[model samples]
Target: MMVPEERRNADAERGEMPVVQGIPIGAPQGGMAMVAFTTLSPEEQVVLNYRLAVMCFAFLDFLTTLLNVLTAVMGTGYYWWELLLLIFLLGPLSGLLGAKHLHQSLTAVYVGFCVLKTIAQIVFAVYFFWLWHILFAFLQIWITKIVFTFCRCLSRIPLERRAQLLDLKEVELRMVYW
Candidate 1:
């Protein structure tokens, strides 16, 4: 029912297509190319989200390490002193490395931290047997489970869905060697 002029005007207002040589560009040269130009891929978003999570975890690790050191310094018992030192050494080290490597590498430092925490929790369960220690053990297990679940879900996402979600575009021009 709408005339060509009206359709062109609507397209211009929406920024859906570029103006080409005074004629409204229909679609990009390729559908995939247009999509790539428009949206961030889902994988990119997931990577970014993972980076943010790592940063948050690193901050928490730093705080926890500091608290542990303070508790140890307060002479809370030799066991507490040793445990706190271990936490101080590993927690901040792994956290800092994970945060620093996030953009450049997909290291398993976070997973390693979780594994170390789990081992520590098991040790606490056997030696301390305190309610707080038990609670912390369970919490670490839960966090590990959740992280694994998220990774699994990300992997299960269909390629097409990922493309649509991520707005991935195919490579266009071939490179020419000089």
Candidate 2:
């Protein structure tokens, strides 16, 4: 039994979701499941790109942690809590909030991530600058730059949104004339 071509095309034109049965999507084409970026609306593309970039940041943090673990195995380095903080804070928050579309909560979490990241960078740089591993110190510098970039992105939300996120109410204005 075959579905008619006209029916399928009409369904697509009417914006109906394709119904699937008995199975789910599997390993993706072109190493990704997503369609071409150009196929997405501009807004959707921006959101997707933002999420992907954050995930990549999280992945890099994990790789850094793995490097540290291996170095520790060789008795040359020890694990650091800062890497865990970076991994947990950078990627997952954006991905989760983006999916939920919780506008108010997003702003608050963004601000919190910014503050914590700033503190982490400050402490890491100040405490580790004198260490012998120049590569590690330089990596911290790069991470600080990355955190600042994220903060800048987060801060670009409208002022009204920030105020709303903070639960600030708008006051009514009244004019009195003599």
Candidate 3:
């Protein structure tokens, strides 16, 4: 077994940072930012993770609303392009507000529910809708399913194997849904 001094030395060698290495920046303004997770308190980390989850929930809602538009056009649901557009804009904005006001765990629950709803709705469309709808739903659900599976796998990882880039709390919060 490793001694306590050895463990502390190893951590110090690894830079003594939080296990979370921070999220990636897809834009060009990034350089070595991957090495940095904000020096925020645990509470701040939770808040940041909650915002990310809330944004994910918002995007899921927008995509679902867009699919509803497709269903309306396909004669399965009511047609309302105006409503879709309104939701496309309002959904994320409202989610942002809600994230700011609601408890993080509550927002996490909403995110989980949205994912389940999206999955169920797509499965329904695949069964009852046209070939094109089936194709669309299948592709969409496949990607979502893969992501869900990945999250579950990530959660199952031994703590030592988890990437320093990952925030375990963030993964744990999202895993509550799966």
Candidate that scores best on TM-score: 1
TM-score ranking from best to worst? Answer: 1, 3, 2
RMSD score of candidate 2 (Å): 16.9
Candidate 2 C-alpha error for residue 169, in Å: 36
Q: Which candidate, 2 or 3, would have the higher lDDT against the true structure?
A: 3
Instruction: Give the higher-TM-score candidate: 2 or 3.
Output: 3
Per-residue lDDT of 3-120 in model 1, one digit per residue for the tens? 7658867898899867542111124464322322333445445543564465566567668867767677666655643654654455445545644443222234555666777889
Instruction: Report residue 36 deviation for candidate 1 (angstroms).
Output: 6.7
Q: In candidate 3, which residue ranges exceed 4 Å CA deviation?
A: 1-46, 63-67, 70-94, 100-109, 112-116, 125-178
Residue-level error in angstroms, candidate 3, position 39: 7.8
Worst 10-residue lDDT window for candidate 1 reads 169-178
Quote model 2's TM-score: 0.30
Q: Write the per-residue lDDT of candidate 2 for residues 49-133, one digit (tens) a residue.
A: 3544544554555465466556554574445743453454443355345323424344345445545545665676677765644
Clashes per prediction? 2, 0, 0
| Alpha-carbon lDDT, every model | 0.54, 0.44, 0.50
Instruction: Choose the strongest candidate by lDDT.
Output: 1
Indicate the residue-level lDDT of 105 in model 2.
Answer: 44
Ranking by lDDT: 1, 3, 2
TM-scores vs. true structure, each candidate: 0.46, 0.30, 0.32
Q: What is the Cα-based lDDT of residue 107 in candidate 1?
A: 32
lDDT of 3: 0.50
